[model samples]
Structures are given as C-alpha cells and as structure tokens.
Target chain A: MPKEYDTFVDDLSTLPEGKELILAIRDLAPGNRKYDTRVVKAILASSANKLPEGDILWLRYQRGSLRPEPWRIKIIDEREGLLLKEKVYDT
Target chain B: MPFRDNREYIEALEKAGEVVRVAQEVDWDLEAGAIIRRSYELKLPAPFFQKIKGYPKGFRMFGGPLANFRRLAIAMDMPADSHPGAILDEYHKRAQHPIKPVIVKDGPCKENVRIGDQVDLYELPAPMVHDGDGGRYISTWHFVLTKDMDSDWVNWGMYRQMIHNSRDMGGLFLPTQDIGVMYYRKYEANNIPMPFATAIGPDPISALASCASYGVGRNEADLAGGIRRAPVELIKCETSDILVPAHAEIIIEGEVLPYKRVDEGPFGEYTGYRSSPRMPRPVYRVKAITFRNDPILTVANMGVPLDDADICLSVCGRTDIKTILDNYGFPITGIHLPPECSGHMIVVAVQAKYTNIASHIANAIWGTKLPYPYIVVVDSDVDPYNITEVLHAIVTKCHPVRGIRAQEFAVGHPLLPFLSLEERMWGKGAAVLLDCTWPLDWPKEIAIPRKASFKEIYPKEIQEKVLNNWKNYGYK
Candidate 1:
C-alpha cells in the first residue's frame, strides 16, 4: 500500500494561535525539510509584524511554483495565526 | 474580452479609483516628467495627464499616475506588497498554461484609420519625458510588430522610437533585439525595408508584459492573452501588414528603410543616467497615424533608477528566471528581482538536494535571456526576498574561491550601462554566480546551533493571552 497520506489543516479557519501553528509545522516538517518550516514561519510572521493593535495577520505557506501549498495568515480574534493547508505542488 | 481596447482599460483604472486626472495644461518636456518623477518618488498611484501643452482638449496624456509598484499590483488584482517574485509566480502560472486569445472581426481601434502620405506623426503628443533625452521617445509602452524572415513568426517588443520630424524618427533596432535582427535580415536578404507599426496606450497588462523578455521568437500578445484570461483583440493597421492591439490609443504605421539613420539618445535610460553620447540609430519614417476619436498619449518616465527599468524590466527578469529554472528541472525554492538592482540583480534560493545544486542553478540562469549581470544562489533555507538574509547566506554559506564561478564572453544588452562602460563590448564580460550552499564535503547529519531560542518560542496559551491583552498593556 502507498504510505498512508495525512491531510494537513483542511480548513484554515480552525487554526489556533501562533504557537500552535508553529507546533503543527514542526510535526509536519521532517528530516531534510526541517529548514522549510522555518522559512514558512518567517514569511508568515512578516505580514503581522507591524499590524495595528488587534489586527490579526492571517497567512498560509505552500510549496512549489504552480499551486503553492496554501500557507495563509489571518488575524483572528486579535491573535495572529498561520494555516498550512496542504502539500500543494510537489517539486 | 481581455480588454476591448485601451479606453476600456483606462475606464477600469478610473473605476478602481487608482488614477488621478491633472486638468492643467502640462508641457511634454520637464513639467510632464516632473509630475511623473514626483509620483514615482512618492511611490503613489499612476498619473493621468488630461491636458498637454500644445494638444487639443480631448487629446489625453497618461503619465506617472500608474507607474509605481503599488499601482501595478493594484491593476493586476493583487495585494499591495506583491513582490517581484510573487508577481513572477502569477506570470509563470499563466505563461506555461496560456489561455489563447480569442479573435474578433472589428474593434474601436479601427474607428479611425489613416494610410499613405497622409500619416502625420507630429499630430500626437509623444512626451519628451526627460531633460537630457535626445528627442521625444514614442515607444516605452509602444509595441512594434515584426515578422521572422524565414518562418514568418511575429514578434512584439518595446523598442525606443524618437521623433525626427513629421515623416521620420530615430529608432533603436538593436541587433540583439528581435526588431533590429528582423530588420537587418530583411534588409540583407530581400533588399527590402522592414514594415513596422507602433502602438501606444494599450491595456496595462499588455504594456507591462511587453516589457518582459519572452525569449526571441515567442508571441508576447498570445502570452498576454493568457494573463488576461481572454484574447487580445488585434486590428490590422491601415498602412502596413502589421497588426496592433485593437484598442491602442494611437498607432503609427511606417516602414524602416535601409541606409536611413539618425542620432537617437543621450536620453536618461533606465540605468539612471543618459546613455553616453548619442549614436546612430535606425529611423522609422511615419507613413500614417491612426487613432480613435479621443486619443490618449502614454508616457513612461525614463532614467534615474526606479523608472521603467525597475517597474517593468525587473518584473520581466524575475518571471523569466523562475520559468527558466523550473524548465531546467532545478529545485528553485524562490527568486527575487529586487527593484534596487534595476532588475538586473537576481538572487535565487534553491533546495540543495545534491552537491553542486547551486552551480546547477547558476548555469540555468546564465543560459537564459534574463541572466542578471550579477547572480547569487543560496540554500533553500535563506529567503531570497530578504536582501540582508540573502547576504547573510552568502557570507556564512559561501567560500570565495570554491563558491564563485564566472561565465566569460556573454552577449550583453546595450542598455546595461555597466557593459558599455567595460573595455570589450562582445562576450568579453563575465558574470559571477555564487554557490552559497553548505559545503558538499560536510557530513549529512552535521549539527548546527539550534535557531529557536527562548526569544523565539512561547507557550501557545501564554502568547494568545498576551495578544488578547495587548490593548490593556497600553500598545495599540
């Protein structure tokens, strides 16, 4: 059988606070791709870095050129969070 | 329709509140350019010059109003901070899978037609954009229609045309550019002058795409169709066999004759300076001038950095880079054509799956038309968008001797002031590609200091709690 595939955040709306999203990426990122998760984080953090108070920075990060893995950021309920939707386009 | 014509696109701009109309009479010389230069310096929306000093009331002029990065993104239906890489991604997605343009029988551009000796080039208000410019340039946003001598392929490109008089003007049909090469071959083989048509004030997307280096023989108009998600309506010109975008504000139909020459520039080019002393350039003798009832003149403020070079050419370079790398089967994580570099400086981030991946990326870039006069390739970990971060990767990951490779004797573009300044013009120059990847000799499991320190992490509950209380803590 093909290695059982797991779906990442199916709906970006359910993503929790900042630390939770980072923890989720840590779980998903493995071995050679360890640095990719960090790259995604920096890109996500930048959007919210200078937002006015309570303006959440919602963002998503995706891989590949065509269909970028849905990496999104939104300021939800005064908290910044990221939603990594799926492995969009494999290199 | 992708856009019915130039007027339709202008209407869209007006509707979006992205354009501001200056009703005062503006001179084509310093006043028009000053307004444009100010818009660029302020990094504001594109400017529309409603009145030209000598032109009629209805004869509109478009200037710096929509020239900056912010306005370009707005027009393309993207967010404000849409970087060059992101925009390139947009173009790449469209170019590879182009939505072919639909053909229509007639369009508004056909509303007015002038052919033969009646074509008066002097009637149009082609802006004398900069002080040091040799003559009034008519083709920054102007697209030239030329066909291949053998295969009969059509090429659309932005070549500079200057006004010499009512019937003639200096044109840069550079040997490297398709127009120059096509004209050269036709002049040599059939002993016939090359027929050409110039269009100004078409759709913003078409104007922007014309600035792209879409390889030598590729049809940019079709590529433009893919971006607009509809066909670019084209109408046959009155005097020439060439076809121009149907809605172009104005069309200059003419033939470039043999043994005809004029001194063209000393104009402020995109390199931020006058292109040395004026040199001999090909002349396009206008045979006819066609336009809609109320024709709008388009202006591209040239020279002194941040003009067409950054906004137009840089976007083209980045788009081509990403597409070229992907086509070469390289794991290019990202690419950036920073505005500061006049789009000639390219930084690439690639996933280093194997040894010499950096070199591979470098080779891929060098082999393409968008080769930056300077290139730096880095490990996927570095953010190509972040200049300081890219530099850090270069400093930390690269060794001077082992990392640097040079390609000598590359065909350089004349606009590259650096190349013209160099001693040898033909392939005598060299390009530096830095391999800023981890040393290939290192162990696969090598350990580096942990990047996540106490400052980088916090419990989710605590972070959420603090953010929720941000107002209570006195910071908005």
Candidate 2:
C-alpha cells in the first residue's frame, strides 16, 4: 500500500513570528523517479501576531517535478520566538 | 560631458574607478572570453585587456563595456549612483531634441587606411567569445551604418558579424527590423550590393543608440548627437558614401552582397541559450579598412544574464515602451523590462480608471516595437520594478482562466530559442497577456480585501513609530 499525507497545512499558528521558514516537501516513497522533492522559504511577519486560517501560501513546483502531493509541516528550528526553519513531508 | 571618442570614454571609466586593467597576456580563443564572462557573472569591474596573445602592444580589447549599472550611469553624464529610472528619464528627455551630424574633413579614424589586397581583418584580435560559437566575431559592440538607395535617410544598427575569411564576414538582418525593412530590403529586391560602413568603437552614446528600436527612417546618428547634446562629427567612408563617427577607433567600409548568402551562427545568443542554428545569411565583403594608431576593439561577451546586452536592452526597452504608452495617453506609473528575462518579459504598472484598463494596456504593448512575448499589467499600487511585489499581484489579483489571454499568431524575434526549428524558420510565434488587476464589475467590498502589510493594517502613527525605532529595536 502507498503511504498518503495531507496536501495542505491545517494549522499555521505553531509557526513562530519574525523568523524565516523553509517549507520543504520531500517524496518518501522509494522507486518513484517521477516524484520530485523541493522547498520554498517565507518569513513570518512580526506585525501580524496570528495567521488567519485558509490563508493561501503559493508554492512553485520545479519543471518536470511531481504534482501537489499529501504533505505535513514541521518546525525545523526556532530562535527568539522567531520561526527560523521548517520542512514538509509528503508520502 | 559628452565623450569625444571611445578612448575618452574608457579613460573616464578608469578615472571613475570602474574599470580594471588586465595587463597579463590572454589568449583570444577562450581565456579572454572566460575572463569577460566571469566578470559579468560576478558583477566585477570592466576588464581592459592590454595584452592579447598574438596582438601587438597598441592592439587592445575592452570586454563587458556597459555591464555595470554605475558604468552606464556614468556614460550618460549622470551621477555614478543614479538609479535605473533616472537613466531612462534622461534618455527620454534627450530624445525629444535631435542634433544632426556635422561632416568633418578628416579625423583619427583615417590615420591609417588600407584598401583591396592590403586589407586584412585577421590582423585585429577578435575574441572567440563562447565555446559553442561558430567562429570569432568582431562586430558584437560595433554599429553598422546603411542608407536607403532612393532615400537620404541613414540607419545605424547593431548587428553581429562573424569572421568568415580575410575579406568576408557573415551577419543576420531580420526582415522585421528597421534596418532590414528600410535599407537591406530595398537593396535585396533590386539585386544591388548595399554600401555599408562598420564603426568598430564609436563613442558610448552612439553604441547605445544603435541598439534602440527607433522607428523606420529614424537616423541613429542624430539620436546619438541628441543624447550627447552636440552634433556628432562624421567622416565619409573610403569605399562607400556612408559616413561614420570621425573619432571612432576603427572603421571598415564594405558592401553587403544582396544575392550572396553565407552560413553563420549556431552561436550563443543574448537569450541565455545557444538556440540559433547554422543558417545562410547575408555576407559583408570588406573593401577598405581604416583605424586610428593602435585602435582598441570593444567587445560584448553575450551568453547569460547580467551582461552588457541585458543592460542595453533593459534601458532601451523601458524608455521605448514608456514613451509609446505615454504618447497614447495611458496613465502609466512605471515600466520595467527586467534584464533576467533577456527582454522577453515586460512589467507595466498603470493607473486604471475605467473597466478592463489592464487588458487594454496589455494589448497595446503587443503592438509596440518591443520584442517581448510576455507582458504583465499591474495596478498603480504595485511596483513593477520589484519582482516580488509584481509576482504577489499576479498571484492574488489574477484569475488564471479569465485574466490570461494568448495570441496564437504573433510576430516573433527570429533569435528566440524557445521556438521549434519549423516555427523559427517560418518566423511565426505566440504572445501572452497577463492582467494582474482587480475586476471592475465587482463591488468595493467584494473586489478589495485588507492587505496583510504593515502600512495597510497598522495605523499611520504606530507604523511611523515602529519604522523610526527600527534600528533601536535590534533591527540592523
């Protein structure tokens, strides 16, 4: 059976403020040559205390990369209440 | 102050601390080309090669002549730190007043002259620019002067010339360009060889004017004169009636054979790709060569982004498009053709008062002389020069289905690498229009949303306070 994941992040409230975050999506399944792993970076604005739900975060897929897949977000690093780094896993 | 000649311009650059003198002997084959390319990629100072492997002491090569923005700013008689918008404004302001050329009896270009059997092009150390180039090119930064047979109007254009032999060179004259339509077409239809003169290193203003897309019958000599705020002094060619810059470093008088065609290209073009295939094009037969004592050859190494060609195209394209839109009474805020796209994409910021104004602007841009295939129109609030802001507008305001339009058949530049061999051969292509503006039919509440920006959400006092105390708040 193929592993499945969510394509969208349900909660972005956990992301720290005033820090840069890299939303990395990786393909975990082996022998899938067509799928591509990529990452995009965005900063959490300090002025905004909270991120509204359903707010869209545009992602760019590389040419010949896999289409949108199930993914989960993770806080890779946090410093001084600022979101420093992040990664998303997709199976 | 206006530069008297190419040498004077180089001197000014050196005095301004924007040029580097490379005294070490470098081979013309690839060593010189690699150095020039690397300098452009790294945004280094212009390289002045004083010693080429086979050339003599006086023979020199200046590479990436206009790659630096500050260098371009200095060339146009502006401040070294002048912004891109200021440079474009200066060009537009000067273009309104054209000063004609004044013919002179003689100049430095005539210090040495060779005709017939004595003329040898190989003596000049022309660098083999790219590794995939078909041959060494001697005319990348040079301007070709041609005149219509029936009309007195003269046209100056920058066209690449590849060295074919000791006396012959191959080049391209696309039918859509002003030079091909106004001058070459007339000669080709009549089966008569067109008289031409190639100015190797004219003043910097003349070189800039040569790359611009001035309308048909527009004389670039006058434009150069206008940009310099003085009439350019011209000296008549030895074998042709076409006049060239009197203070030019080197001038070659030649005749472009209308009936003759020679194989040229498969070289790397300004599009950041090696897309042009080897094909037969017009050949220029050298009849006379003249130059000053120990003339310097100016070369522009074209391949990737941030090169001299990108600088020229961005400045010229922006000025040309802005002038066109303004003349048509469009309330345009700003226009920019980013150099990263190699003049293929244009971003226009305009004030929309009526319905579908963005769509109208996009269509109008397509009809202009610009070679761009993709155009994006944004609201006045958006900054077209800022790529990130423009992309955000495209993402938020644009509807992928309704706001995007495509034309199946559009005039395309022959040098565009993305086109297939058949499409390029037929000179047929497509153009796209992207409108990144709010819909006019929607109500204010529906069309507008609260922006998540500091200036938009926060009160003016709080925003100002935060900005004023930014440095004190541990923000460097």
Per-candidate DockQ values are 0.01, 0.01
Error of 2 at B397 (Å): 2.4
lDDT of 2 at B432: 84
Give every collision pair in model 2.
A6-A71
**Per-residue alpha-carbon lDDT of model 2 for A1-91, expressed as tens digits?**
3332111122345444445665432223322110122334444432212432212222222111123432223334422211112111000
Give the per-prediction TM-score of chain B.
0.88, 0.97
The clash numbers for all candidates, in the given order, read: 27, 1
TM-score of 1: 0.75
In CAPRI terms, model 2 is classed as incorrect
**DockQ, Cα level, model 1:** 0.01
Tens digits of per-residue lDDT for model 2 on B163-185? Answer: 76567777777877766775456
My TM-score estimates for the predictions, one after another, are 0.75, 0.82
The parts of candidate 1 lying over 4 Å away from their true place are A1-91, B15-17, B78-86, B102-105, B400-402, B420-428, B443-476
